[model samples]
Target: MLRIKGTIGDWPVDLTVEMDDADWARLAQNLPVNVAAPTAAAGATPVASAPVDQLWLAAQDLLRRSGGTEGPQLMSELEALAGSAGAAKGLLVRLRHSPKVKIEVREGVQVFNWVEE
Candidate 1:
């Protein structure tokens, strides 16, 4: 299980998405418009396993439309995506809004640890 975690504004959220390498390759090979390819890796695991790019893209898209507004709407969308993925066992989201947020990812059901300010 691969996890994709991040914040939408002042809300910290985590998303668990299936990390199907095949699917990731397929998707990456055929990434949609405006969707940048995941960071390149030379190892057996393709770039799809890294959800940071996707999360960042999604956040940027939402923020671009926020008109500089800061709130929880983006966080809500991220949470919905996590639930939609149907692999999240637990999640921790904190809103610190300290001009920067921290993100950490690891193996085993993926871990998304971040502080949202």
Candidate 2:
């Protein structure tokens, strides 16, 4: 028998689990094994960023400068960078769905927030 008494997340808990030698032997079979982590060298250099990734980064930067931006304003900036309304629209769609972006409405206007990395 294994007796455990403790408090978890502000709640007091008391638990008793009974197991024979055979039960303990079977428990080991159900347990998961852990893999060791690979160690990096002491002076590892960071990987360089690809140019394509920079476009999204630049968009986020523009949002940061504005502290959050409306859809039209952001599209305008994207158009300036992409050199075409179609290309800018594609980028806008990508930005809208990106994990780093937060979309909201302010005064009936859709605003996009660039979350910090």
Candidate 3:
């Protein structure tokens, strides 16, 4: 059994998932066991290695260079950079929440702008 409790925006979420041995086995089959998870020491910033971090930096650079971009166009560029829709969307979500990025709606279209510090 797996329990997930969190908030989506202002809404509360509590979820529970259950799986039998076969289900677990099937799920595990699709996951890579060789890759070790990244870890951070106490009081230190967590680090994500390669492609993930590189992709994130590139995503930020893309926004910075553009000054501001429409939401869908940014997603398309990120998808090309990350080489997968899932990875692209992950970067987009991170950008949306980042302190360095600002979101606004321009003429009914969502835009992402880099916030200079």
Candidate 4:
């Protein structure tokens, strides 16, 4: 038996899950979105454009480095990053420290590029 509680958007929810290995496997396969971990915290904030702009820059850089690859894992990671605070509006700006770049089965790879205008 495992209990989990979290919030998505304005909804605060709690869950009590009891399952065996087989059940867990089935659940994992059935609901892949339910089994994602959050990204690490980027303390303070760097001077950057809006969250959307920052995301674009970061994504472009990652894509360039990754050779414009596309896959699932990368997409998921992107979603997580975007969902983080100040991501869409371009406020929260910080680069990944470790791995520098990682591969996502769905997303392929990261591609971010900062621009000056």
Candidate 5:
């Protein structure tokens, strides 16, 4: 038996299911796997996953647009734009050490602001 409870948007969802041994055995036979390939888009470079160069560019853009943003807020926006949390985290960590990056605290929250040279 499997049960799940959660809310999506405004509605609450509660689900329960009973699966026999045969049901589990059937699912084990073939589980879908995702496979990705790198392919060039127009004149752009081939990218299998989120490219570091583009991620950096987007991070800078966000800082410039918003003046400064909280770490978690920046991360969420990056994930939405780049589709990967790993890529966002990598960008933020590198950005934190860059001399061009400006960090400040406002209302007890750390903020990252881009410093233009």
Candidate 6:
């Protein structure tokens, strides 16, 4: 089951979706899989994967290249880049808190700008 509660244009929204096992399997099939196994040398601890770091760098680059991007559009692109809505939202939250990024409201829409150091 998945529950989404939010507001759209000042209107409240509550949604719930239930899925069976087969539905879950189908959903899983569409998700990206990290197939690479972690490896370490003898007596060495396996290092944690840093795909999020790479994604963060890429997200910054995207903003840098765009100069400034509208919030919704940027989120759509980020979702595509991150391969998951959760990851994309996480990146968006990080960007919101990043000192290198500036957020502005224009015509009631958010615009994210990259602050070059």
Clashing pairs for predicted structure model 1, backbone only? 12-93, 96-116, 96-117, 97-116, 97-117
List the candidate numbers ranked by lDDT, top first: 6, 3, 2, 5, 4, 1
Better of 5 and 6 by TM-score: 6
Full-model lDDT, candidate 6: 0.73
Clashes of 4: 34
Which candidate, 1 or 6, would have the higher TM-score against the true structure? 6
Error of 6 at 74 (Å): 0.4
The digit string of per-residue lDDT tens for model 1 on 26-90 reads: 44333222334445446656544445346444444444444332233435554553443211111
Better of 2 and 4 by lDDT: 2
**lDDT of model 3 at position 72:** 98
Could you give candidate 3's per-residue lDDT for residues 24-78 as a string of tens digits?
Answer: 3454344222222334558998664543554566778889999999999999998
TM-score of 5: 0.52
lDDT of 3 at 21: 40
Error (Å) of candidate 6 at residue 57 is: 0.4
Q: Mind giving the per-residue lDDT tens digits that candidate 2 earns over 1-117?
A: 556799999999999877654554354333232222223358986455433344545555667777788998899987787556765665676667566789999998889998866
Q: What is the TM-score of each candidate against the true structure?
A: 0.27, 0.52, 0.59, 0.29, 0.52, 0.59
Off by over 4 Å in 6: 1-49
Q: Where is model 4 more than 4 Å wrong at Cα? A: 1-48, 84-117
Q: What does candidate 6's lDDT look like per residue over 17-64, in tens digits?
A: 776545544544444432233345699966664544456667778888
CA lDDT of 74 in candidate 2?
90
For candidate 4, lDDT tens digit of each residue in 16-82? Answer: 8765534533432332132123233489445633334444455545545555444443455555655
Candidate 3 segments exceeding 4 Å error: 1-49
Report the error of model 4 at residue 44, Å.
Answer: 20
Candidate 4 CA-lDDT value: 0.42
lDDT of 5 by residue, 1-117 (tens): 446699999999999866554553353234222223223569896554333444455566777888788988988986666556765555566567566778898888878988888
